[model samples]
Target: MYDSILVPTDGSEGAEAAARHGLNLATAFDSQIHFLSVVDERSYSSALADLDPTVGEQREGFEQQATEAVECLEEMVTEPPVTCQTAVKHGVPHEEIRSYAADHDIDLISMGTQGRTGLDRLLLGSVTERVVRTSDVPVLTTRHEPDRSRYDRILIPTDGSEAATAAIAHGVAIADRFDSTVHALSVVDVGGVVGAYDAGPGIPELIDSLEEECEQAVTVVEEECENRDIDIVTEVVQGPPYRAIQEYVDREGIDFVSMGTHGRTGLERYLIGSVTERTVRTSDVPVLTVR
Candidate 1:
């Protein structure tokens, strides 16, 4: 369903990985690919005084670097034969990316969760984090090299919230495009409940209730999958949501994860809960965050 896919790069290893994955997706959808490398003008200007006579030359050098980074990505697009374009923008990295996506009608923005330096603290950079928080479109992030093979299994973690519903649409779109099987997971946060209460006497009943809720959540995902004519497998378990998702990804050989950046319950549960933040930091494959 993606029309124009944007891949913002800074010539980092992480960005290289994202470019591969983005190209794969574009090839699959037969969509146009746009490679954007934004020059952080603020960083350059601060590092080199604007009053300096050489400052203009330094800016030109930065633009040249951006062009070279985009060319590298373009060279990698030959195997699947996707239409590719490149651009260099000057501004804050995240804002430039968001603005380009909006102005260009980009369907998705695929980026690295980390950069060469401290741009990304752990999972993603401040720019990536801000884009994930504010972007109107889905943002696909990768911390590892892309598998390249068509995703055989795609994971969709849900909590039956509006945000999760939005994520489902993106997940189903990708799964449908690749003809991949969808695994819908709903985790019961029994640990959260136990932490909130001192006694374990009511833990069993609470766990049971959480499982019931999990079932309802997965049912919502199942119905969506059925509507899309995509194959689906469902699971419900009791544990910390992020751990549950990571464990499931490893256990089931999940190639990708699609979920919301924030959940309807706010900061309480997984699938955009704190769990999403943790999962992004630790996931071995790409994680797609839709808001």
Candidate 2:
């Protein structure tokens, strides 16, 4: 469980949406929320050279905006007794975010992204992707768009693997908290085997056995969630893991994807390299990845 959450806000719509979810998480754990705004000092410094000698007003404007951003978030921290704290620092956004989280002993970081893709993302270099990749702690991220399902439906993507179960436990808690229904998904990497070759003798039995295996595997996961009284819905899909999860999220109108980090680098989680990394990088909705 998280003890304290750090959220970076640029006052953009994307960041505002993330703050909404961040509050829910902070409330869940009775955790304090740290809101930070980075001044993009590199850009500011470059602009400074071109500013008028009487640029004092411009500097004051920056201070005023930073204060407004912090106060706005403080007002929003109405639930979970979130002890809202804010700081404005001058630096690159991602570096400032990572460094602050490290120094403050932040339990989790929740931030927003535009969810850029392909060339756009390649060109701009996503801050969310970088932070998720480099940060020592877990990250839950959101985009600018608001999700309508919020408290009604939650999605948990599983693979019937031990790693996937990590999300199941957390997902049940999430569903219970919102009094919402839980939909459990296990995406098998069956595409390769299915599309690879021609049928052989007893292929029918093999196919039947495979289907049964999928059912039994997913059933155990669903039953565990049922114990928590979270109305359970289950699905078995075939494709690449990340693609299947993303497609299921889109098709089922999922509000959130709670997952786990299977492999941790070491005690400090100083390094993490897994498929979850790839999924978080591509997911469009908010993701809660627990280790």
Candidate 3:
């Protein structure tokens, strides 16, 4: 379904790993590959002050790195036999990424969760997290390079919200393209409810309520996949959401997880953090976050 794929590079191992997966997807779908390198102008002020007075050494240095990074990605694109384009822009990395995708009609953006030296350790790297939060299109992220073949099984986690339904559409589209199986999973967070209560008097009723929600969530996926004639298996389990997703991935050999940024749980839950972001941080497989 992708027409053009964008890979933002910073000449880091993490970015290179993401590029590998992007190239593989581009090849599979016959899509063009676009490379972007944004020079973080904010990082240059102090360094520029120390450079030679007559020379614009810092700016030139950043441009050179951006150029080389894109060139290296271009070379890597040959095996896939797809057209490749590159650009070096100077601005905030996440803003530049979003702007480039819009201006260039990029269908998908594949990136790494962490840069060469990302600042955040407790959450997703700054630029990536921002892009995931704001991008209008799907953003695919990988912690490590993915296999060069089709995804074996794609998982779509749902909570029956509009955002989750948006993810379900993308998941089905991708699964259709690769002839892959779709795993529709909904986790009832019984642990979350139980942990809030010191005593277990109302826990069973609460668990039952959550289980009903899970069933409805899974039904959303089931209906979508059914309409598309895509093969799908559905599951509803009770546990912590992120842990349940991770365990499901390992148990089913899931190679990709496509999820929404916010679910039926709403913005408040995402404001604190999200199961989606946590999964992105911990999933060994690639994640495609759709907003």
**Best-performing candidate as measured by lDDT:** 1
Q: 2 or 3: which has the higher TM-score?
A: 3
lDDT of 1 by residue, 1-291 (tens): 888999999888888888888987898888899999988876457466467758767777777877888899888877645788899888888888999999999999998988756422212366777887889999988898875658889999987778888898888888998999999999887767777788667777777777787899899889988998999999998787888899999999999999988875632365554677677767889999988
Top-down lDDT ranking: 1, 3, 2
Q: Give the Cα error of residue 97 in candidate 2, in Å.
A: 1.9
Better of 1 and 3 by lDDT: 1
Least well predicted 10-residue stretch by lDDT in candidate 3: 264-273
**Structural similarity to truth (TM-score) of each candidate:** 0.91, 0.71, 0.89
Candidate 3 error regions (>4 Å): 46-55, 79-81, 118-124, 196-201, 266-273
lDDT (Cα) of model 3:
0.82
lDDT value for model 2: 0.68
Residue pair clashes in candidate 2: none
Which order, best to worst by TM-score?
1, 3, 2
lDDT of 3 by residue, 173-285 (tens): 88988889999998877656766677567777767777787788888888888898989999988777889899999999998999998776531121113788888887899
lDDT of each: 0.83, 0.68, 0.82
